[model samples]
Target: MQIVILNDAAAVAAYGANIFATQLQKKPTSVLGLATGSTPVALYQELIAKNKAGEISFSQATTFNLDEYLGLTGDHPQSYRHFMNEQLFSHIDINKDNTFVPPGDALNPITACKEYEDKIVAAGGVDVQLLGIGRNGHIGFNEPSSGLRSRTRVKTLTKATVDDNARFFAADEYQPQLSITMGIGTILEAKKVVLLATGENKADAVRAMIEGPLMAACPASALQLHQDAVIVIDKAAASKLADLEFYQHIEAENQKLQAHLATL
Candidate 1:
């Protein structure tokens, strides 16, 4: 994993936006895997700025969100669909037809999950996936104990995740017990993955993901297996990582080595 420790949340977001912009430059019609939460808000804002400057365009890009509360209406204030619209879609030029959020209130959830995967396949699969690690290490809504090879499916939110997400809902009663999320296998298929974390609240999870054993207890640890995953975190979130200075030195040395190789 390539870990970048930025000075603060805004810097982390700027770095993530630059990564996304770089990918868009390579593939203008790229399919993007998106996540919703406090962590990605600033990144979305930076993308909006790029859109406004005409430095990047989303008109041809397609997006698929990571997860959504199973019983909530798309219009519900607390729904992931609502979150995406307010934070991203409203500010960008992406076509409404190319944006997809899993059907939260689908009566036939199994079929819905299958169809969602089919849609992604039809769209050429995601070129880059953005992720946020939950305090308990869940990715999307696939909480702990989720099989590594799981596909798009309905998941029962763990108490920790429910509590973590409760802040968005007006009341505890409004929180959904279930959610629809793309599985670990689906995420692993992405050509590139960028995971971001910003606050002290995420420090432990971030540390576990990069350093601890690749156990199912922390689902984000699965990224250790991805060849093209990069993790961008603010200093606060990287606090628990051991030998952080060593990693920094290694990155610097590698850059110097690359420059020397280019000259030769």
Candidate 2:
């Protein structure tokens, strides 16, 4: 995992958006694995601005979201599908038919999960997967203790996850305790992964994901095994990482190397 600590959340969002912009410029048909949450809101906003400025276009791009609540439909106000539409899709030129989200209300979710995996494989796999690490180090709703090699499927949400998401619903409304998410192994198959986090609430998860052992207990730690995974965060989120100075030195050296290579 390449750890980058930015000055603030806006910096982190800009950095992550640049990754998507570069990828889209290089491969217009690139497949993107997306995540939903407050962490990615700013990044999506930046991408929308870039699209409007004619800096990047998603006309040929296809996107697959990481997860969806089990009890909702694509049209549901709080569904991941709607969230993506409101946050990023409606403003871009991408075909709505090209965007895929798990079938949260499918009568046969087992079959739905399998089909979701098939669609991903048929699309030539995700070029870059965008993610946000949960406070407990979960990725794509693959909560702590989730098998490292699991695939797309329905899984029960931990009480902690439900509580964390409670802020999004009314006090009387129910929050689904189940979700369909792409598995850790599935996410690792992507060509590149960009994980974003901000705020002090995420600092510990960031530390564990970047420096902790590669184990199921901290699902985000699985990124350690990926060849190209970038963890972008603001100082608040990166605060608990003990090797901050070393990471900064490495990034600086890498920048110098790239600059020299560009002149070659």
Candidate 3:
């Protein structure tokens, strides 16, 4: 449950990109868990910059996206598949064959969910997972009340998630009521996890995830139990944290250690 308070959203994104680059350096074919939403847009941009600089190459990497709207086709403007293409896939060198997004339009969504999890297992599991929290603390589309051990499955979206995601669609009516998402159990299997939050809208959720009880009410709180999870937030999003200075000191120490390792 490490927290990093960045000076701004760009700093958060830069740090996240560095983390991704570090993983790719260690394992050229690393399996990456990706997420959609405004919170990760800047991070994707930073990744693109790294790719352009030849600092990192995603050509051999495999990607598994967290979720997709159940009824939406891949071409739908509001679909997570489309969102990933526009935000990331198009700009990166990764092969299309190595990327997987849950089949949103599958006639049998339950089967599709099971197969999605199976695909991840066959790919050797995710090395690192990127997450964005919903306003209600949902991860992927696993809303509140989702069991900790739940597998990939179809989930009904809460009205708040619909509203928060409505901006991507032409109208609220276009938002899908159901989504297929990786379960918290699946996410916890990743070797490392990075969750990002920016803006004041996320402040309360960030505080609850870090300081509040690990109740199902806030699904992101489950990260508290993960051994290598990092929550990188901008100042605005970290506003509700009580021990802000303590977190900063810890990040500074981590930076010093990283620098020492690099010199060695």
- Please name the candidate that would achieve the greatest lDDT relative to the true structure: 2
lDDT of 3 by residue, 1-264 (tens): 778998899999989988999999889999999999898999999999888899899999999999999998898878889989999999999998898999999989988988999999999999999999987888888899888877899989999998898787775366688899999999989999999999899988888888889878888888998999999999999998898889999989998998999999
Give the C-alpha miss distance for residue 256 in model 3, angstroms: 2.6
lDDT of 1: 0.92
Using TM-score as the measure, the top candidate is 2
Give the candidate order by descending TM-score.
2, 3, 1
Give me the runs in candidate 3 sitting further than 4 Å from their true place: none
RMSD of each: 1.5, 0.7, 1.2
Give lDDT tens digits, candidate 1, residues 1-264: 888888999999999999999888878999999999899999999999999999999999999999989998899988899999999999899997899999998999999999999999999999999999999998998788888888999999999988887777776366789999999989989989999998999999998889989878888988999999999999899899897998788778877997999999
lDDT of 2 by residue, 1-264 (tens): 788889999999999999999999999999999999999999999999999999999999999999999989889888899999999999999999999999999999999999999999999999999999999999999999999988999989999899999999889987899999999999999999999999999999999999999999999999999999999999999888899999999988988998999999
Clashes of 1: 0
Predicted structure 2: lDDT: 0.95
The Cα local distance difference test for each model comes to 0.92, 0.95, 0.91
- TM-scores across all candidates? 0.96, 0.99, 0.97
